[model samples]
Target: MKLPRSIRVIERGWLSANNIVLEERSEAVVVDSGYVAHAPQTLALLERALAGKKLARLVNTHCHSDHMGGNAAIQKKFGCAISIPQGEAPAIDNWDEQQLILAVADQRAQAFSYDDTFRDGDVLQMGGLDWQVIAAPGHDTHAVMFHSPEARVLISGDALWENGFGVVFPQLFGRETALAETRATLEAVGRLDVDVVIPGHGPPFGDAGAALERAFHRLEGYEQDIARLARHCAKVMLSFSLLEKRSMPLAELPAYVARVPILAELNSRYLRMTHAAMAEWLVNELERAGAAGRREGLLLARGE
Candidate 1:
């Protein structure tokens, strides 16, 4: 997996978004700060990657907690200017937990301020390479992807993964345009002359066309049955919580699901199961998927 000499990809596990450090001359730019729980690790990686150079800027593709949770810590450490997608600017400025999806999902991310915001079609010069910011509104309505023409590389933030795109999150929020936007976003990516794609959660891959085909296939299934997508979202949220908490008492799991707003919404809209039932189902599903296991009286996250 040889990447351009100027950019370094720090592939964080599923709990944290990958961080891309772009170095040019004496300054550095970091994209996506990862989850707050891993802020210290993110900083250590940056320190090693940036060496003695100054971190000049930090940019986020979306307001997702896994991607932007370390903003405050990084800002405090480097005094770097922060840039975020324009659509999430107001949420960040107001520090409204309810407005941000992180809060809705019951995820934790320390509030932080942004120095500026970039809109779709914006061009950024980082690591002496020109990258264009393009709107990607499926996984996140305000998400953006960065494309470098010379390198034929794209930083696809949760928009297009090697296996499939992220969950159509807007659909869960009662937005009907989500499927259409996702289809359009995929088409837009298809039009780009990309040789490599750096996805938000996976390792960089070179087969953009094949990945698109996979994404389209997944989209077709989701379009046909949104219940499937909602189920996936439920599992993902539970998996993420497990990844963060490691384990929880079996008895407490029900109340836990009931507490998260997004989990409750998923239950009410699609699953329609009681919180206890949802929690039990989630645990069973996780165990079935080998993502979790039961030990004694506790449900333990897998591979922990």
Candidate 2:
């Protein structure tokens, strides 16, 4: 489906979330800056897209490291006002690494402040369109999605991807409501009149019906077996680390998993495997999924 001319999506790889630009007459608004490691690239892309037009604001669907990693850089370059979900205000204001899952997952994002906060039911004007803020609480408890009813477009962050939504981190952390919340989020999205989806990690897709069905199937599997969910989270965390670092020494995998708080916690709670075993299992799983490769005593992130 063709997106509105005012909307532009800067598709990115797994390490970073895609950047969405809403160009107005004299100014523009950006949604979700990419990962911190790609801040320079994000700025370069924005410079080209904006073409001297003012970037009036930076908004986030959630507070994940990958999604908001380049916030500081964008603010520094464009001096745009940053706005985030109201639920995330406390965490972002304090720069709580644990609450934001940065230190917990061994991810990094430069701390940046927000000028305002938007909550569910709020309407934002961007690119001459009215986008309604809808609470999407599965991926991140406080996450929200923006939908433009007139444009029939949904900016679904990690909440609802084309294949499946993001890993339900709250479930891994023993939040009993996570699975239900995920299901509810999907139901909410299903109620929207969305003809196009701008997801956080992948290209914009028009098959919203098919995507929701797949997401429900994935959620059903997780709901039936929490252990499976734990394992999936572990593999994702490890893969993200590898993506950021490019490659890790084979010999250090075990220690690396043990040091990362989230990985270590997952191993302790659900997997209950020796650190070495957990590391080996993660590498094997990632390899089987084509997310990583081993060569010359190093585990390298493959195919992004």
Candidate 3:
């Protein structure tokens, strides 16, 4: 990887977001602590990487549980100052799990406080490099990406990935302009002179141009039929659920889907199928796509 000598990448699997640790002399910055389920692992990685120095600050590209779920554990451990997108400060301050998508999807995140907020065009300095904060609003309305012109590096938080980007939650909630926002975000990323991209999920990739091309092509395909986009979101949520729970009894899948407000809402708006039908369809789709498999009336999330 062409990363700074001071930066270390912690590659996490699907359920937990990747963590980037940038150490500079007396200061250390950790970005996007993984899911709470993996907090212990995250802490271990940070401890080994930091050696004995305390973590100075924590930054979240967005407030998604996978991205910031480890915040409480990390903050408690290091007493680090936290920074997050300015738009989500209200929901964080109020601890609205519902608004945070925690209650709706039954996702978990321990509450943590942020001491500072960043907006689009703001500059953040870490590891002796200045990163420009760029707004990226489709995936999560308040998401942002950090770009280091000096290093030709872009920390793309769900805006652009090696394969595809994150699910556009805003679109499933009837925000028609969300897809357009995603397109705009992609365009903004395309305009950057990037050499390496540190994505929110997968490992860092070198060919930024190729990734942007793939992302734009997928964006165009989704634009043709919004329902197709909705179906993608449903599968993503289902896969995430499967990732969380290694396996679930066949009979419980529908009830499980029905219990998740966000999944049910997506089905109501797009799939429009009953819980049983939707469950079967989602599972079938996953199996067909080779992302999951059914064994003895139980669904297992396939390892990627």
Candidate 4:
């Protein structure tokens, strides 16, 4: 799919969310600055893309580590103002690692201040188009997506991926409305007149209808079995850690899961397995799903 000449999508790997650059007349705006560990690369890429134009602002769909980790670096390098969803402003301002899922999930993001926040119904002019901010609450209760009606494009930040949406973390944490909110979010996406969807972690894709169908089906499965959702979340968290660390010693994998608050909570609440068993299951699941592989004494990230 051909995006507007003013808009550029930099598809990143699973460890980092994709970065979208919106070129304006004199300055540019960036959406979602990949993971903190990849900040240097992100800056390098933006330098080439922006050429000599100044970066006016940096915006985020949500404040997840992978999606907004590079905020501090970007702001320091370009002197760009940062904006985030109004719902996440408090967490960001307070630097609450628990609420941000950084400590809970064993993830990391640099603390950064935002100049402003946007809410649903707000219109942001980017790349010469007015993109409407839409609330998307499931993966992260404060997450949002952007849709440009004139361009028929949607920047879905882990809300509605081509194969499936992001993990509903609230559900695993015992939020009764999480599943329903996910359904509502998907239904809302179904109502949009979108020709292309630029997801947070994948390449831009067309065929929004098919993507919604797949997301709905996946949601239905999660609705049927909450344990299934927990297991999926466990695998995802583990795979993400593997991606960040490259490899982990097989002997320490069990202790690693036990030490991580989210993984420990998931095992106690849903899986109800011993730490060793949980680690074994996670390793096997990742290998089976082609997300990880066991080599010698290490569990290595695969197909990232």
All candidates' lDDT scores? 0.89, 0.93, 0.88, 0.92
Please tell me which model should have the higher TM-score, number 1 or number 2. Answer: 2
User: TM per model?
Assistant: 0.96, 0.98, 0.96, 0.98
lDDT tens digits by residue: candidate 1, 117-217: 99888899888899999999888788999999998989999999999987775356656688889999999999998988998988999999999999999
lDDT of 3 by residue, 232-266 (tens): 98898888878888888989988988889988888
Candidate 4 clashing pairs?
none
TM-score of 2: 0.98
Which candidate has the top score in lDDT?
Answer: 2
Error of 2 at 135 (Å): 0.2
Which residue segments of model 3 deviate by more than 4 Å?
A: none
Colliding residue pairs in candidate 1: none
Give the per-residue lDDT of model 4 (tens digit) for 20-122.
9999898999999999999999999999889999999999999999999999999999999999999999999899998888988989999999999999999
For model 1, what is the error of residue 84's alpha carbon versus the real structure, in angstroms, after optimal superposition? 0.6
lDDT of 4 at 28: 96
